[model samples]
Target: MRISVVIPAHNEEAYLPRALGAVAAQTLKPLEVIVVDNASTDRTREVAEAHGARVVLCARKGVAFARQAGLLAARGEWVAMTDADSLPTERWLERLTARAGGAVALYGPLRFYGVSPFEATLSEQGYRAFLNLMALLGRPNLAGANMMLLKEAALWVGGFPEVEAREDVLLGWRLRRLGPVRYVPEALVLTSARRLQGGWGPFLLRQVRNLLGDPRGYFGEGGERER
Candidate 1:
């Protein structure tokens, strides 16, 4: 099956090359690599084009908009989504494709990288514990940085919801109704821990607020789902 890798970038010139390199080195190569430049002020477009990736410029400034644009442009049987700052393992695509059967959507694990020792331990342990608890309750929150979806399945859900945050979770819920979403732990992606640079206290607090349905803290005031 043909797989298209879509990367949403915004001022990510410094990291785009590495992410694209990882894609090039994948054991199971993707049919195409698309970089959606989300109104970046930096050299994101130039870097992506330099890496031989097809760059699509999205005038909108949100990740969701960029992702939807890429999906619309994708011509592969399956679409894999990853952030500009994240890097997949050599076997990432191979593992995802292996697990794609019998499911409409697939999600893998995301590991935090480029962090201080203290921050890394805390972030990793905290998230693992939180996910374990959620699993026990039969609730799973999917991460966009390590997700794959069939093109038909994505179209059935009307594409991703153009929200500033938690779009992955919202879309996962919708896709789950159409078919099962398989979790493949072996297909891991390395994501930057820059969010922890702001301190875990504030980060965890914001996550808590968001989980509690505080729309202001999660999606901002009056932030409804976009078409």
Candidate 2:
């Protein structure tokens, strides 16, 4: 199936290049690379264009809206979603597509870059445990940074809700109702540790809060400023 990789970016001038470069390096290259510029005041559009990514403008201020815009514009049979601050492994796309095997969606592990080794290990292990638990409950543990889904499946779920956080997880839950959501442990993506600026303790606490209740982790800070 043809794949379109969509990246929802907001003021990601500092990190867009790395994200785009990783897409370009994918073993199974995408049919198209789309970068949804979410009202970025920075050079996000220009940078995306420079990397040969089609720039889709979303004046709306949230990642959810930006993602919906990209999904609407995407023409590929499958959609690969990643954040502007994340770096997919060279074989990320190839592995995901290979393992799709009739599944409607796929999600994998994430390893944070620019973080201490101890922190990375802890976070990775914790996330894996969470994924396992969710699987037991017939729910999906999907991260926007490393997920692939059928474009038709995403549209069927009404795209992503215009919420501040947990939109990825919400989308996954809806998709699961239609068909299987595959887990790919080796198709890892390296994401920015910028979110941990306040230190690991608070960052982790905020993550739990995001998972348990409303997501005040990422979008609550006003989309553009944080990304």
Candidate 3:
């Protein structure tokens, strides 16, 4: 499958290079790498261009807007969504394509970078269990940090909701209505634990709210608006 990797970055110059480097080292090279510059005053665009990623200027400055902009500019049948602070494994894309089959959306588990290998494994396992349960509930937990979807299917579903929170989950739910949304555990990604550094309590609480079908609870209005 021709895949286009999209990373929505806003003033993430320090973290963008590592993410782009991981993409460059992917065993299954993508059709294109689109970096959405979300009105950043920093050198996000230059850094992306330096890493050979085609830059898509998105002045809207919202995570959802950046994601949608990148999706619109993608020239591949599949779109691999990842965060600017995420480092996907070398075989990430390879594994995704190997098990793609007729699945409309395929997502894998993610672990933090600073955590121990054992801790990462634990995190991955926990996430996989959560994902399996969510799938049973007909709501696949598709995080933008490690999700791949058919471009056509996503567009047909009207793309990501304009909402700030749970857009990824909402898209997964919408895509699941069309066909299978599978979880590929072997395709793993390592992301920064910056969000959880504050504490797991707040992070887990927000996630719980989302899974409870309430994205508007914590992050909906004037709270952690960016991805």
Candidate 4:
């Protein structure tokens, strides 16, 4: 099956090239690369077009809306989701597809970049532990920055809700009811730690809220989904 990689970006001119470059270098080339310009005032659209990514404008201004627009515009059978500040591995798509047996949607861990060494290491270990705990509880957290889903499966569940955060997990919950949702550790991506600028105090609280499946994490801050 062909894969279409989708990126939701908002004024990510500085970081978008890395993501688009990774997509360009994927072992299994996606059928297309779509960059959803999430109401950005910068050169997001220009950068995406420069990298040969088809630009789709999401004027409503939210990750959920941007993702829904991508799901609708995607031409491939499966849609790969990643953030503007994230870099999927060279074989990220290949690995995810290889491990996908009966799973309709699956996500993997993220190794951070642009952050301290401690934060980078913590991201991997923390993700592993969280994945394990959520799997045991039957609520796999499909991160917006490192997950892949069948276009049909995602759309059938009403796409992403209009919430500010936890939209990825919400979609995962909906897909779990339809079929198995697996966590593949090998399908890793490198993400930016700009969001963690506040440090681990707020980070740990976000983790707790994530476990509780709370939608109020980034609600007041902005509509951008957690990266």
Candidate 5:
């Protein structure tokens, strides 16, 4: 199956190289790598082009919009999404493709990188605790930092929401209704912990609220509610 790796970037010149390199080095190379530049004022586009990634200019600013733009342009049957600051293992795509055959969507765990000692400890502990809470509540909205979906399934669901945040969760909820949404534990992606550390309290508070179904705080007005 052809797989397209879509990365939504905004002023990520510093991290784009590493992320792209990881993609290039994947054991299961994607059919194409599409980097959607979200009106970046930096050299994000140049860096992506330098690494031979097909760069798409997204006039919009939000991650959701950029992701949609990339997905719409992707030429692969399967689309895998990752952040510009995240790094996937060499076998990440291989594992994802293997587990995605019977499911409309597949998501993996995200490990934090470049975190301070205290923040790392808190992140590790808190992330697991939150997962436990989600399981207990029978909620399985996975993070978008490491996810893959069949293009047909995404199209059938009318693509991702046009919100600023929490679009991944919203999309996951919609996909779950169509068929099984599997969580592949073997495919792990490492994401930077900058946002979590820079605004720990508020970031977590908003996450808790989203988990409780208050998605408006993350998506602003006119956003769809979680199913």
Candidate 6:
């Protein structure tokens, strides 16, 4: 199946290169890569174009809006979502396609890169474990950093929600209503640990709030400006 990879970037000049590099090195190449520049003051657009990614400008500035823009621009049957700061494993796409079968949506784990080993283990690894456990509990634990969904399914679900927080999980839940949403353990992506800059306590607390279906609790007035 042809895949279109979408990356939403906002002032991501520092991390976009590594992300695009990973996509270039994918064992299973995507048909297209769309980088949504969400009102970035930095050179996010230039970086994306340099990496041969189609750059789409989202003047409104929000991950949700950027994601929807890329989804609309995509030509592939399957749309893959990843942040500009995320580095997909070489076999990421290959594994997802292999495990997809007739599934409508597929998500995998995200491990943090370019961070202290201790922090990575505690934050990234721990979070991944939590995601797996949440899945076992029948919770929607999908992440935009490493997930794919049928284009038709996404369109039917009205694309991603306009909200900033937990839009990924919301989309997953909506997609599940149409068909099965599977988790492929082997399909992995390495994302930036910048979000955890505050502290473990705060980050985990925010995660717990989201787990309880309260994205608004931590990220107030959700938008591209927040994170």
lDDT per residue as tens, model 6, 1-227: 99999999999998899999999999999999999999999999898999899998899977878888888989999999999889999999999999888899999988887787887676656877788777776666778898998999989877777675677887786788788899888898888888778966887886786567654523444322222
Model 4 segments beyond 4 Å from truth? 214-227
Q: What overall lDDT, based on C-alpha atoms, would model 2 receive against the true structure?
A: 0.85
**Candidate that beats the other on lDDT, 2 or 6, i.e. the better one:** 2
Worst 10 residues of 4 by lDDT: 218-227
Clashes of each: 0, 0, 0, 0, 0, 0
Candidate 1 CA-lDDT value: 0.80
The runs of at least 3 residues in candidate 1 whose Cα sits more than 4 Å from the true structure, single-residue gaps closed, are 206-227
lDDT of 5 by residue, 101-207 (tens): 68988887777889767766677567756755664565556677788988888888867887777788778777877887877778878889876755778988867
The 10-residue segment of model 3 with minimum total lDDT is: 218-227
Q: Which is superior by lDDT, 5 or 6?
A: 6
Query: What lDDT is obtained when candidate 6 is compared to the true structure?
Result: 0.84
Clashing pairs in 2: none
TM-score for every candidate vs. truth?
0.87, 0.89, 0.91, 0.92, 0.89, 0.91
Task: Flag clash pairs in model 4.
Answer: none
User: Which model scores highest in TM-score?
Assistant: 4
lDDT (Cα, tens digit) per residue for candidate 1, span 1-227:
89999999999999999899999999998999999999999999999999999998999888778888898899898999998889998999999999888788888777688976776666656666665554455445567788898888877887777567777766666677788777777887888888667876887886564355433422433334432
Name the lDDT value of residue 125 in candidate 6: 69
Lowest lDDT block of 10, candidate 5:
217-226
Model 6 bad stretches (over 4 Å): 215-227
Q: Cα RMSD to native, each candidate?
A: 3.0, 4.8, 3.8, 3.8, 2.3, 3.9
Q: What are the lDDT figures for the candidates, one per model?
A: 0.80, 0.85, 0.87, 0.87, 0.83, 0.84
Total colliding residue pairs, candidate 6 = 0
The better candidate by TM-score, 3 or 6, is: 3
